[model samples]
Target: MKNIIGAKLKAYRAKNGVSQFDLALKSKGKLSTSTTSTAETVTNYDPRLSTFIEMYRYVDTPFDELLTEMGYGESYQSTWYKRHKGNS
Candidate 1:
């Protein structure tokens, strides 16, 4: 699902009119010292959950609205169950 995450990240970035480098810098600031170095190493367009959360904080869109825009609907529970039935 990296592609999906990447698309979502790109959409959010565009909505905020920020570049990938700027987003990366903002994400890096949200990390703790131990994870700071690793966080800063993210050079690709893919974004982590924490990074997305931080972005949401700066944007006018709500979390659910963003998720819906990303094609993630309210059926998350059912979707998760289907993807990991054996593990559960």
Candidate 2:
């Protein structure tokens, strides 16, 4: 895998004018500058579930839009919600 999520996150960061440092700061220890950089540039990056959530949440990226862009259909989205709901 080529880290599709990270690429989309980079695009979102650029679109929203948010720097890595800013994202890390905004995350309040949920994220870090190094982690953000690695996520954007590392081909083998495997981020945690919370990392994915916080990154997208920081840039206000819509979950449905991201899933669609990543080639996951609406079915998977609903399945994900069903499985993960109330866990957090």
Candidate 3:
């Protein structure tokens, strides 16, 4: 499957004139250059959930939108919610 999340991340950064290095910097150690790089360039990489959360928050995208864009159905959504809901 295509890495839609990565593509969206790249697009968000590009649209906002933010470089990967700057992204990491702006994140203030919540994210790293290597992490951003792998997410953007690694075709088959499945990033951790926290990474997704951080990136989504950083780019001001809604979590529901992210899950939807990833093509996850209701089951996955409920599971993800159950696992991460109160933890947020």
State which candidate has the highest TM-score.
Answer: 3
For each candidate, what TM-score against the reference?
A: 0.40, 0.67, 0.73
Q: What is the C-alpha RMSD of each candidate to the true structure, in Å?
A: 8.9, 4.7, 4.3
Candidate 3 C-alpha lDDT tens digits along 1-88: 3466777778888899998888888888777888888888988868787887777765545666667667664566666687787596
State each model's CA lDDT, in order.
0.53, 0.75, 0.75
Candidate number that wins on TM-score, 2 or 3: 3
lDDT of 3 at 9: 79
Better of 1 and 3 by TM-score: 3
Error of 3 at 70 (Å): 1.2
Least well predicted 10-residue stretch by lDDT in candidate 2: 58-67
